[model samples]
Target: MKHYIYLFTLVCIMMSCKKPYNPPVTTTNYNYLVIEGLINTGQDSTIYKLSRTVPIGSAIANSPESGATVTIENDKSNVYALKEIRKGIYAAGLNLDTTHKYRLRVKTTDGKEYLSDFVQAKDSPTIDSVQYEYTGNAENIYSYTHDPKNNTRYYRWEYQETYLYYSPVPSYYIFKNNSIVPTNADDETQVCYISDTSSTILLNSTAKLVQDVIYKNPITVVPITLDKLKVRYSILVKQYALTADAYNYYQNLKKDTENLGSIFDAQPSAAATNIHCISNPGVPVLGYIAAGSVSQERIFIDRSDFYAASVGVDYSYCGGAVITYKATQRTPYPDIITIGTDIPTDSLVAAPILGSKDSLFTIQYATAACVDCTLKGSNKKPAFWK
Candidate 1:
């Protein structure tokens, strides 16, 4: 009885001590203009993403700044306009003169203008290769590069990974007219290619080394059980040349966005940027703009390579277990061939009931996500796919 009384007192104290804690960053509205992108002098398109910072507790991830007139201004009085392809994304293929200096200029819908410091066009060295290797527990994908001229000591990289994934079960029929019918001849529902871009900053430097060479910097890690290993996968790595100031800015950004997690971790610091608001000198803008040509390299990985080592990959979570539905006299035919709550897989066969006036049919139904690959990714094949 005494122990129960002590436990009750402790529980009451614990419940009473609980209170909601709100941080300044979460409650404070510190929305500021954020610019991301570089002036690409290479064959690739130069793209920019403009957004506004949001509170930590806000439901939105980013607030895009649209209807902005963005341009690339050169020191020689030449200006190239960038068209807005998406909400806040601006892009254009600039035939920039390598001898001239360039800067980014932005005009917001709210009549605010921003500009970056004029910078020289730096040419990026070609990547040596992008390859993947099994690392016991997972696959490590890496990129290699070197600047023979030693001009590009600082570098940054970004990658796009595409993988061929399939549904748990292939559906040859589709649900139509309240019944099952053969899928269209041109439709390919079982196979698809999905792609994703790198979100974290990838930066490297060889300033301290004797030669400006980086060998096999870890670019991506693929889990052994990922669906990416279930079939064919490819990664496209793009490299950019960066100045020492730009490198330091990205280092600060990495510390701010990707570093802080626990109390023992490094605290967030102010990120450096070359961008400034021309309209209001005191108004702060986030981002670093540099004029550079991008270098690219691509590599493909085959599932057969993994199978040789008896490694396994899974896509079973797509769903499992289909139900066989049968029609009866009470319910002669279902207007919708759904099995319980499961969606119709559009697979069925008519079986005449022995000595019965009504014709009975059995239907197989599975989750729509399981039967149709299009539910998860585009059914169309990627343009670069073999």
Candidate 2:
């Protein structure tokens, strides 16, 4: 009887036990800013991105101060004030020139302050020349090569362009292998690069004869008297940024490049345009035409406008790359030759035509000759033959 009573008492004690304490859940907030753009107005402009630094432990985004003020300036008198484009993107009117040093300062909408050390922009190097040649397995494409004879000089390019055409759809056709291709042919603008190596060396050379020879007998096109292209070159400035900062800067520049897709971005088309006239007095011949048997006087017409820009910094400097600009032609260039020079006098004498803005193209150091830089001599190599 006593044992039974003890068991019943133990059961009551077990049922009366309590659970552990629990705490209330809490939440935090954090925010971060991302900047992705470039200063390519051809003049001076500074792009400054702003955002609140996000915290690691917070799930909520921080509310950035809306009335923030940012400023960028160079050692010279040039100064630019940042204007808010979006919630976190701030822009300034400071023009971009590589000859000066720049510093960035920010004042948040709530009066918070941020600053960046002085960043020096590098001067533009001379371009030897801008030249192109046939490339690829079938030699169906043309490319640019750079050839600054002086090893100490460097260069980059940016194009201002306009695509001129007229139609209900603003498109046109270019002949390829005896076939007509309909493309957007719309007026637009953007920045592009020379991604091939062979094209790079060719781009840097200043030899006009080399360019003439290549254009006379293009790798892809039918080498006829009418097959000519107009090409021009200009001096461009090279900039420097730290290695870690380059990737971020490139992404931003690309974003701005994507915005140049408007119909009004190119020049207006005229019913009558100037073609090469035979034997004009007082005018120097720019190019030669390839006829059935004999070469004649004809101006070369560039179907695509090209540009190149270089970017680098002093500390642990990295080489630059090339960018190209064109309308709606998306053909690949397998083998390219680029010829360029930094000398202002040797550069082509043309400015960005108003109402006819060509897209910008950039070329930096990364555009080197191919590991196997072989020219297709009469062997009819697949890469050099059409």
Candidate 3:
């Protein structure tokens, strides 16, 4: 009887094998509001960026939430309105008292209202230094700071980087007045400044340690092959002290959305936000508002600091095609002389073709991008550039 039962069970298990399972597509709609930015208590301007969340598979990251009435209010009912400078950005000059509690209030174009939890302003300590360490193929930037009162144990950082870039070919001519004229070296758009801001959330905590000291906390890393490291590089780091609640909110956000869809990772959970929809109690709003005075420091790194082996990747792909201009050809030269529209191509001085007559010659030229650095960056140097 036992042998018969075992044979039946094995037959049942073999028959149970079937095709792969396909989960149904999720049809849920999400249009939650996202508020970002801190309430500045210092002399600097306080800016808020408002946007609506998009679907996971959508090509657009976040849809701008525009035409909103944004204000910073204190517990004492003092309100400061922020001007909508652009599509979704709002800005206002602030000099709030550090002792009072503050929050952000928003009235959107759709007539919906939202408010952030009241938060006390936290002051950030000055960064002792912004240092760097060169690994085998990358340079890592780090910051150090400490709170003497041990009040600020949680911290967040944001940084902006600017680098000097140069064109592979120096442009020496411009096509103007229906003729090619020699370009002045001073006005030559060969060198330019390119800048970028931090996107990922960077946070640290010194709560467990006896002293509130953050040492060598890595802020960002620049690969040696990146063009930013090819010449001179500069970074401006801004530090903000966070409340425990605010720190936890950002930490959870980083884990859920920032590192989503990784195998062996924690299951995704909805990040709790301090903001709420005043018009509807159950509706979800995304983001946390923190009140604080930001501390900033800027550092410049020269190309001489790196090893020759780690200089930079070859950017020869930038420009190479050569067009020969001959005086003999008529019919008003082709528009190919310019890069895309107006920018003129560069002249190859070393390999100019000499004509039979002493005064006649043909010159080799290439596209504007290869010769104009301004195509990728600004020709004007930054005021803070050293």
What are the C-alpha RMSDs, in order, of all predicted structures? Answer: 5.5, 28.6, 5.6
Clash counts per candidate, in order, are: 0, 94, 0
Full ranking by TM-score: 1, 3, 2
**TM-score of each model, paired residue for residue:** 0.84, 0.28, 0.83
Q: Which number leads on TM-score?
A: 1
TM-score, prediction 1: 0.84
Mind giving the per-residue lDDT tens digits that candidate 1 earns over 1-386?
99999999999999999997755565666779889888988777899999999887788997998999999999988889999999999999886777888999999988989989998889999899888888666779999999999999999999998888887777776554554556786566678788889999999999999999999898989886677777888889999999999899998899888888777878887777888898999999988999888889888888777544433454456554444334653253354443323344555566776887655566555666666666667777778786
Model 3 TM-score, all chains together: 0.83
lDDT of 3 by residue, 1-386 (tens): 99999999999898897566666765455788889899999889999999987876777876998899999999999999999999999999989999999999999988889998899999999899999998978899999999999999999999999999987766666555666567675565778999999989999999899999999999999998888999899999999999999999989988986786556888888777889999987888888999989999999988998675866668666554544444444223445553243343544333335654322223456566676677788888999999
Per-residue error (Å), model 3, residue 5:
27
lDDT of 2: 0.32
Cα distance off (Å), candidate 1, residue 295: 0.5
Top of the candidates by lDDT: 3
**Comparison by TM-score, 2 against 3, better one:** 3
Off by over 4 Å in 1: 1-29, 174-181, 307-343, 351-359
lDDT of 2 by residue, 1-386 (tens): 99999999998888778566655544433233233234332344445444455555566455344666666656786767778877766665554665566665555444345444454443323222333443321112332323233221222223221111111111122223433333232311111111111111111212334331222222123121111221221112122212223323333343444434555554332111111222332221111110001011111223344321321112222233333434222222212322211101111122343576653333222221111111111111222111
- For model 2, the superposed segments whose C-alpha errors exceed 4 Å read 1-31, 36-43, 49-67, 73-80, 83-100, 110-112, 127-386
